[model samples]
Target: MCFGPFKRVCHWGPLVALGIIKAITFSTVTCLSQWWPPQQSASGTLVFVAFSSSAVLTLYFFLQAMFTGPGVLPAGWRPEVEGDTRYLQYQKH
Candidate 1:
């Protein structure tokens, strides 16, 4: 998929994985809600809390992955010269 603002291209694999994760989370929450005690006054609150927490965690991880830099190049790797920067092809703005 294309991110319009960033002008970046993202592959479909991550999107598919995210959809699968959301589906699993919803299924789990549904199961939990059904298994919760019917007599309890807090069943709805419990499910809400569970779902919210899951969403929050997922967002946290997504942000973390987005913000983290790609990491350094291999050890001892260096360009031939200052004017020769062909190796630095993926510099971010």
Candidate 2:
């Protein structure tokens, strides 16, 4: 994916996720009774800002992780020795 709104994704996972997110957002907006018939937009503006910010941030991180590799894992999670089945045992969920 490119770093832009018109970014293209080779795989379908992120695209599906993005579509789901948008659908949920629109559904939420429509389900809110106060969303329409707004006497004043100040409160609505605040709500919109809060919600849009959350969505944007979520999308940002989602795309970031998808495009960039999932970054690095912390050290010590992997056993240094080969065939180290010991570390795999007793992992606390």
Candidate 3:
């Protein structure tokens, strides 16, 4: 079977979306850092907050992509699973 134009477009759509997400995330983190003084503690805190927040957001995107659908996540981001499935268990809402 042949995939045709749609296959190619779909393949690149995620990457483009991911790029956009990264840019936005970076900008947001940078802006947030200004709220803290430029001391060593502030720098460290900024790093920690940015990394942790990014990880959480990325995970959310991945979950949305899966159980919900691909478009649930930003274009390029994808979710990953590992271990005893603890990462996937959801609390009943």
Question: Considering every candidate listed, which one attains the maximal lDDT?
Answer: 2
In order, the Cα lDDT scores of the candidates are 0.67, 0.68, 0.59
TM-score of each: 0.50, 0.55, 0.38
TM-score of model 1 vs. true structure: 0.50
Off by over 4 Å in 2: 1-8, 31-41, 72-93
Which is the winner by TM-score between candidate 2 and candidate 3? 2
Candidate 3, residues 1-93: lDDT per residue as tens digits? 326533433545665766677787777667656665446586768775777687578957754663353334354443564454565434356
Q: In angstroms, give how far residue 37 of model 1 lies from its true place.
A: 5.5
RMSD of each predicted structure: 8.4, 7.2, 13.1
Backbone clash tally for model 3? 3
Error of 2 at 83 (Å): 16
Model 2's lDDT to the true fold? 0.68
Which model is ahead, 1 or 3, in terms of TM-score? 1
